[model samples]
Target: MKLKKLMTILLTTVITTAVLTGCGQQENAKDAQKKPLKVATNATFVPFEFKGDGDSDYKGYEVDMIRAVGRVMGRDIEFNNIPFSGIIPIIQSGDMDVAASGMTITKERAGKVLFAAPFYESKLVILTNKNSGIKSVEDLKNHSVAVQMGTTAADYAQNLGLKTKQFDHNAEALMELKIGGSDAVIADKPVADYYVATEGKGEDVVIPIPDSKKEYLAFAMNAKNKDLQKEINAAIAKLKETGEFQQIYKKWFNVDPGDLPKTAEETLQ
Candidate 1:
């Protein structure tokens, strides 16, 4: 009778243990499936990422492209709005999984983060009020130029020994130009063009510098996330081949993406 009782107790204990283990495994699987891909972006740049008027949601070319990438990787994407200067550090700290805010790939940036394939080619342009008479890079000499802080445009302006007014956003820099606080605003060509069109700055001019080098924009992540980088690279290649990339480009820029390099490394060559 004692043996029968002992057997029954052992059976019940074994069944309970097995059920608990199964439940734990199922919960772990669900947690893995629910993990989101956190993407960090600065939403001040239009055509790249920005908040629309009267809208709480962020939208732009980069936002759309990253969403497509998330779909390709079978992950839910969550965007976190962060300052441009802090985006890299946040990714390095593992607080964010990706940074895709029209970030231009540079040697300094490459050392800190792993960049995916190039998604867009851009150039700096000088934007000035029509009557400002700033027609070229040389004209910026002795003029108070406005640029977004931590951007290549600001670096270029400082390198040229020009007096510069730094703003957190490109829109503020352009507004400084309009208000006569700055003689000119130097920024990405697409951003300048977008501002001019939307702000009713019909008199503004976009002056492309002849010697300015092209900047290749790409998504960046922590160096340790090589697997994620590879997946993103594959997604970008697939998007390009499937015509989805060109469609997004046309939707944002109103023109075909003509002969742009397939990867950031390709631009180096």
Candidate 2:
């Protein structure tokens, strides 16, 4: 009897240890799968990412593209709608996994974040009240132009000898134009066009600046996230090849994308 009792105790101890070990491994697997990708972006840019009218849900081209990326990676995504100024810092500090707010891929930005392949080629344009008499960059010489603080538009206008009024967001600059505090506003062509079409300012504003100054937009990941950057580029290539990219482009802007080199006649005319 003593021998049998001793054997039974040892068997129970071994079984309990095995069960605990299996439970721990199961918990570890669950923990590993719980980590979802987090993408940060400035949600104020329309036709890219913005609060859907009459709802809290986000709606825009960038939002759709990122969703497609999540499907490709087989991972869930969480969007952090931060300000443009905070996006780079958040990603650098490891607070976000990706940044994709129609961010421009410029030399200055490349130094801060790893950029994916160019997603959209954009042009900068100036917007002014139709009655403001500002028909071009040349006309901006004597007028007060408003741009969002810390924007490329602000920097470009300031360097070009225009009197600049800076605000925290493009909406604020547009407000300045509406209130007659500023004579004009400079911004990307898409945002300017969105404001004109959706903000009840179609006849009030016009794109005064031309396409001579164009910029390419891209996604940004932390410099350390080479894997994520590769995944994004691959997905973008797939999107382009399937004509989904062109469809999204036309859905937002009525024009066919003109990124490829234009003929001399097209360029001149």
- Candidate with maximal lDDT: 1
lDDT tens digits, residues 104-203, model 1?
9888888888989888889999988888878789988968999998889999999999999998776688789888899888899999889889883588
- Across 1-269, the per-residue lDDT of candidate 2 in tens digits comes to 99999999999999999999999999997775456779897777777887865878877877877877676666787888876778888989988988878776666777788877765667888877777787789988998989877667877888888899987656678888888898888888788888888874455675646544667777788988787778777877777678776677777777776663221112212
Please report how far candidate 1 places residue 25 from its true position, in Å. 8.5
Candidate 2: C-alpha RMSD to true structure equals: 6.5
Quote the positional error of residue 123 for candidate 2 in Å: 1.0
**Candidate of highest TM-score:** 1
Q: List the residue pairs that clash in candidate 1.
A: none
Candidate 1 runs further than 4 Å off: 1-34
TM-score of each: 0.87, 0.79
Clashing pairs in 2: none
Q: Whole-model lDDT for model 2 versus the true structure?
A: 0.76
